[model samples]
Target: MKVLALLLASLAAVSAQTEPWCRCAAFVTYEHSEIMVFEAPEVTIDSCTDDAKQCKNSCTKELNDFSNNGNLWLVQENGLTVGQNICTYMADHFFYFIHNHRVYGYFEVCGGAWEYTGVASQQLLCCNGGKHEHCISK
Candidate 1:
Protein backbone atom coordinates (compact mmCIF):
# COMPACT_ATOMS: atom_id res chain seq x y z
CA MET A 1 0.00 0.00 0.00
CA LYS A 2 2.83 2.43 0.68
CA VAL A 3 4.31 1.97 -2.77
CA LEU A 4 0.93 2.33 -4.45
CA ALA A 5 0.21 5.60 -2.62
CA LEU A 6 3.60 7.04 -3.58
CA LEU A 7 3.06 6.19 -7.24
CA LEU A 8 -0.34 7.84 -7.25
CA ALA A 9 1.01 11.05 -5.71
CA SER A 10 3.79 11.23 -8.26
CA LEU A 11 1.36 10.80 -11.14
CA ALA A 12 -0.84 13.58 -9.83
CA ALA A 13 2.05 16.02 -9.59
CA VAL A 14 3.18 15.28 -13.12
CA SER A 15 -0.31 15.71 -14.48
CA ALA A 16 -0.68 19.09 -12.81
CA GLN A 17 2.56 20.34 -14.25
CA THR A 18 1.78 19.19 -17.78
CA GLU A 19 -1.69 20.69 -17.85
CA PRO A 20 -2.23 23.85 -19.91
CA TRP A 21 -3.31 27.22 -18.56
CA CYS A 22 -6.41 27.75 -20.70
CA ARG A 23 -8.22 27.02 -23.96
CA CYS A 24 -9.87 29.55 -26.24
CA ALA A 25 -12.05 29.91 -29.34
CA ALA A 26 -12.32 32.95 -31.60
CA PHE A 27 -15.00 34.15 -33.97
CA VAL A 28 -15.31 36.91 -36.51
CA THR A 29 -18.43 38.46 -37.99
CA TYR A 30 -18.45 40.52 -41.16
CA GLU A 31 -21.19 43.05 -41.78
CA HIS A 32 -23.35 41.11 -39.30
CA SER A 33 -23.98 38.57 -42.05
CA GLU A 34 -21.02 36.20 -42.19
CA ILE A 35 -19.34 34.48 -39.27
CA MET A 36 -16.09 32.57 -38.95
CA VAL A 37 -14.91 30.41 -36.08
CA PHE A 38 -11.46 29.31 -34.93
CA GLU A 39 -10.61 26.93 -32.10
CA ALA A 40 -7.14 26.98 -30.61
CA PRO A 41 -5.21 24.66 -28.32
CA GLU A 42 -4.60 25.31 -24.65
CA VAL A 43 -2.34 28.35 -24.23
CA THR A 44 -1.36 31.12 -21.85
CA ILE A 45 -3.00 34.53 -21.54
CA ASP A 46 -0.07 36.31 -23.13
CA SER A 47 -0.19 33.99 -26.09
CA CYS A 48 -3.89 34.60 -26.42
CA THR A 49 -3.34 38.34 -26.42
CA ASP A 50 -0.84 38.05 -29.23
CA ASP A 51 -3.14 35.75 -31.15
CA ALA A 52 -6.05 38.14 -30.79
CA LYS A 53 -3.99 40.98 -32.12
CA GLN A 54 -2.79 39.00 -35.09
CA CYS A 55 -6.26 37.79 -35.97
CA LYS A 56 -7.64 41.29 -35.90
CA ASN A 57 -4.89 42.55 -38.15
CA SER A 58 -5.32 39.77 -40.68
CA CYS A 59 -9.07 40.13 -40.80
CA THR A 60 -8.89 43.86 -41.35
CA LYS A 61 -6.56 43.41 -44.27
CA GLU A 62 -8.53 40.56 -45.75
CA LEU A 63 -11.87 42.23 -45.41
CA ASN A 64 -11.62 45.86 -46.35
CA ASP A 65 -15.28 46.58 -45.64
CA PHE A 66 -15.26 45.01 -42.19
CA SER A 67 -17.54 46.30 -39.51
CA ASN A 68 -16.30 47.30 -36.08
CA ASN A 69 -19.03 45.41 -34.24
CA GLY A 70 -17.94 41.80 -34.06
CA ASN A 71 -17.92 39.01 -31.50
CA LEU A 72 -15.13 36.87 -29.99
CA TRP A 73 -15.73 34.06 -27.54
CA LEU A 74 -13.10 32.54 -25.24
CA VAL A 75 -13.46 29.67 -22.81
CA GLN A 76 -11.19 29.31 -19.79
CA GLU A 77 -10.93 25.66 -18.84
CA ASN A 78 -8.81 25.89 -15.73
CA GLY A 79 -7.27 22.59 -14.67
CA LEU A 80 -8.85 20.75 -17.59
CA THR A 81 -7.82 18.81 -20.66
CA VAL A 82 -8.82 19.42 -24.29
CA GLY A 83 -8.92 16.49 -26.64
CA GLN A 84 -11.48 14.87 -28.89
CA ASN A 85 -14.09 15.72 -26.31
CA ILE A 86 -15.02 19.37 -26.96
CA CYS A 87 -18.00 19.57 -24.62
CA THR A 88 -16.13 19.69 -21.34
CA TYR A 89 -15.52 23.43 -21.26
CA MET A 90 -17.75 26.47 -20.96
CA ALA A 91 -17.10 29.48 -23.19
CA ASP A 92 -17.10 33.08 -22.05
CA HIS A 93 -18.11 35.42 -24.86
CA PHE A 94 -16.54 38.78 -25.66
CA PHE A 95 -17.29 41.57 -28.11
CA TYR A 96 -14.81 43.62 -30.13
CA PHE A 97 -14.84 46.73 -32.27
CA ILE A 98 -12.57 47.39 -35.24
CA HIS A 99 -11.95 50.90 -36.45
CA ASN A 100 -9.64 52.31 -39.13
CA HIS A 101 -8.12 48.90 -39.80
CA ARG A 102 -7.11 48.61 -36.15
CA VAL A 103 -8.47 46.67 -33.20
CA TYR A 104 -10.08 48.76 -30.52
CA GLY A 105 -12.38 48.01 -27.60
CA TYR A 106 -12.94 44.62 -25.98
CA PHE A 107 -14.86 42.83 -23.26
CA GLU A 108 -13.09 40.67 -20.66
CA VAL A 109 -14.39 37.46 -19.19
CA CYS A 110 -13.81 38.12 -15.49
CA GLY A 111 -15.92 39.31 -12.58
CA GLY A 112 -19.18 39.47 -14.52
CA ALA A 113 -17.53 40.91 -17.62
CA TRP A 114 -16.16 44.41 -18.22
CA GLU A 115 -15.66 46.58 -21.28
CA TYR A 116 -12.59 48.61 -22.20
CA THR A 117 -12.15 50.90 -25.17
CA GLY A 118 -8.59 51.42 -26.34
CA VAL A 119 -6.29 51.35 -29.33
CA ALA A 120 -3.55 48.77 -29.94
CA SER A 121 -0.54 48.83 -32.25
CA GLN A 122 1.22 45.65 -33.27
CA GLN A 123 4.98 45.25 -33.74
CA LEU A 124 6.20 42.18 -35.53
CA LEU A 125 8.59 40.45 -33.15
CA CYS A 126 9.60 36.90 -32.40
CA CYS A 127 8.26 36.57 -28.87
CA ASN A 128 9.17 33.26 -27.31
CA GLY A 129 7.61 33.84 -23.90
CA GLY A 130 10.16 36.45 -22.73
CA LYS A 131 13.10 34.62 -24.26
CA HIS A 132 13.58 36.91 -27.27
CA GLU A 133 11.92 39.82 -29.09
CA HIS A 134 13.34 40.14 -32.57
CA CYS A 135 11.71 41.68 -35.61
CA ILE A 136 10.11 38.87 -37.56
CA SER A 137 8.74 40.97 -40.42
CA LYS A 138 11.88 42.94 -41.15
Candidate 2:
Protein backbone atom coordinates (compact mmCIF):
# COMPACT_ATOMS: atom_id res chain seq x y z
CA MET A 1 0.00 0.00 0.00
CA LYS A 2 2.81 2.41 0.78
CA VAL A 3 4.34 1.70 -2.59
CA LEU A 4 1.02 2.43 -4.24
CA ALA A 5 0.78 5.71 -2.38
CA LEU A 6 4.26 6.70 -3.48
CA LEU A 7 3.48 5.89 -7.08
CA LEU A 8 0.35 8.01 -7.01
CA ALA A 9 2.24 10.92 -5.53
CA SER A 10 4.91 10.70 -8.18
CA LEU A 11 2.32 10.71 -10.92
CA ALA A 12 0.69 13.79 -9.53
CA ALA A 13 3.99 15.62 -9.53
CA VAL A 14 4.78 14.62 -13.09
CA SER A 15 1.37 15.63 -14.32
CA ALA A 16 1.75 18.98 -12.69
CA GLN A 17 5.01 19.66 -14.47
CA THR A 18 3.71 18.42 -17.79
CA GLU A 19 1.33 21.34 -18.23
CA PRO A 20 1.77 23.54 -21.31
CA TRP A 21 4.11 26.50 -21.11
CA CYS A 22 3.53 28.18 -24.43
CA ARG A 23 0.94 28.23 -27.17
CA CYS A 24 0.40 29.72 -30.65
CA ALA A 25 -2.69 29.30 -32.75
CA ALA A 26 -2.84 30.00 -36.46
CA PHE A 27 -5.96 31.90 -37.40
CA VAL A 28 -7.13 32.47 -40.94
CA THR A 29 -9.74 35.11 -40.42
CA TYR A 30 -9.66 36.03 -44.09
CA GLU A 31 -9.68 32.53 -45.51
CA HIS A 32 -11.02 29.76 -43.29
CA SER A 33 -11.62 31.78 -40.16
CA GLU A 34 -10.33 28.77 -38.26
CA ILE A 35 -7.78 28.69 -35.50
CA MET A 36 -5.08 26.05 -35.37
CA VAL A 37 -3.76 25.88 -31.86
CA PHE A 38 -0.30 24.75 -30.81
CA GLU A 39 1.21 24.42 -27.39
CA ALA A 40 4.34 23.00 -25.80
CA PRO A 41 4.24 20.34 -23.11
CA GLU A 42 4.55 21.44 -19.54
CA VAL A 43 8.10 22.40 -18.58
CA THR A 44 9.91 24.59 -16.14
CA ILE A 45 9.86 28.33 -16.61
CA ASP A 46 13.38 28.26 -18.10
CA SER A 47 12.59 25.55 -20.62
CA CYS A 48 9.30 27.25 -21.37
CA THR A 49 11.21 30.36 -22.40
CA ASP A 50 13.38 28.39 -24.78
CA ASP A 51 10.45 26.48 -26.23
CA ALA A 52 8.43 29.66 -26.65
CA LYS A 53 11.26 31.21 -28.61
CA GLN A 54 11.63 28.09 -30.76
CA CYS A 55 7.90 27.90 -31.49
CA LYS A 56 7.80 31.52 -32.51
CA ASN A 57 10.74 31.06 -34.83
CA SER A 58 9.44 27.84 -36.38
CA CYS A 59 5.83 28.97 -36.81
CA THR A 60 6.82 32.28 -38.34
CA LYS A 61 9.19 30.60 -40.76
CA GLU A 62 6.59 28.06 -41.77
CA LEU A 63 4.02 30.75 -42.48
CA ASN A 64 6.49 32.77 -44.50
CA ASP A 65 7.46 29.75 -46.57
CA PHE A 66 3.90 28.58 -47.05
CA SER A 67 2.61 32.00 -48.08
CA ASN A 68 5.76 33.40 -49.69
CA ASN A 69 5.21 36.39 -47.48
CA GLY A 70 8.06 38.50 -46.23
CA ASN A 71 10.02 37.15 -43.30
CA LEU A 72 8.06 37.45 -40.06
CA TRP A 73 10.28 37.13 -37.05
CA LEU A 74 9.66 37.36 -33.30
CA VAL A 75 12.56 39.10 -31.70
CA GLN A 76 12.85 37.88 -28.10
CA GLU A 77 13.66 41.22 -26.59
CA ASN A 78 13.17 39.79 -23.09
CA GLY A 79 13.77 36.21 -22.05
CA LEU A 80 10.52 35.71 -20.17
CA THR A 81 8.42 32.67 -19.35
CA VAL A 82 5.36 31.41 -17.40
CA GLY A 83 4.64 32.79 -13.93
CA GLN A 84 6.28 36.01 -14.95
CA ASN A 85 3.89 38.86 -14.37
CA ILE A 86 5.26 40.96 -17.18
CA CYS A 87 3.92 40.10 -20.63
CA THR A 88 6.78 39.43 -23.02
CA TYR A 89 6.26 40.95 -26.45
CA MET A 90 7.39 39.51 -29.72
CA ALA A 91 7.71 41.25 -33.09
CA ASP A 92 4.32 42.78 -32.31
CA HIS A 93 2.52 39.60 -33.34
CA PHE A 94 2.87 37.13 -30.48
CA PHE A 95 2.76 37.61 -26.74
CA TYR A 96 3.80 35.43 -23.78
CA PHE A 97 1.40 33.13 -21.93
CA ILE A 98 1.64 30.42 -19.30
CA HIS A 99 0.12 26.95 -18.73
CA ASN A 100 -1.61 26.31 -22.03
CA HIS A 101 -1.36 23.13 -24.14
CA ARG A 102 -3.05 21.75 -27.24
CA VAL A 103 -3.31 18.17 -28.54
CA TYR A 104 -3.82 15.43 -26.00
CA GLY A 105 -0.93 13.20 -24.88
CA TYR A 106 1.65 15.35 -26.66
CA PHE A 107 4.75 16.78 -25.15
CA GLU A 108 5.24 19.56 -27.68
CA VAL A 109 3.18 21.75 -29.99
CA CYS A 110 4.07 24.20 -32.78
CA GLY A 111 2.41 25.64 -35.89
CA GLY A 112 2.02 28.71 -38.12
CA ALA A 113 -0.31 30.66 -40.43
CA TRP A 114 -0.38 33.77 -42.59
CA GLU A 115 -2.55 36.07 -40.51
CA TYR A 116 -2.87 39.65 -41.62
CA THR A 117 -4.75 42.70 -40.47
CA GLY A 118 -5.75 45.52 -42.78
CA VAL A 119 -3.08 47.50 -40.98
CA ALA A 120 -0.32 45.08 -41.89
CA SER A 121 1.19 47.92 -43.87
CA GLN A 122 1.28 49.90 -40.66
CA GLN A 123 1.90 47.20 -38.06
CA LEU A 124 3.20 43.70 -37.62
CA LEU A 125 0.63 40.90 -37.40
CA CYS A 126 1.39 38.75 -34.37
CA CYS A 127 0.19 36.20 -31.80
CA ASN A 128 -0.43 36.84 -28.14
CA GLY A 129 -3.05 34.53 -26.67
CA GLY A 130 -5.06 36.31 -29.41
CA LYS A 131 -3.93 38.13 -32.54
CA HIS A 132 -2.40 41.55 -32.16
CA GLU A 133 -1.32 43.57 -35.16
CA HIS A 134 0.46 46.70 -34.15
CA CYS A 135 3.82 48.41 -33.98
CA ILE A 136 5.90 47.94 -30.85
CA SER A 137 5.10 50.82 -28.61
CA LYS A 138 8.08 52.97 -27.78
Q: TM-score, each model?
A: 0.21, 0.29
Q: What is the lDDT of residue 75 in candidate 2?
A: 34
lDDT tens readout by residue for model 2, 1-138? 999999999999978765334342333223343332332232333354346555445445443432233222333234322112112222223544312221111122322223232111112333345333333443
lDDT of 1: 0.30
Q: Assess candidate 2 and give its TM-score to the true structure.
A: 0.29
Can you list the residue pairs that collide in candidate 1? none
- Give the distance in Å from residue 70's predicted Cα in candidate 2 to where it truly belongs: 7.0
**lDDT winner among the candidates?**
2
Model 2 residue 4 distance off true place after TM-score fit, in angstroms: 8.1
Off by over 4 Å in 2: 1-8, 12-25, 30-34, 37-46, 70-138
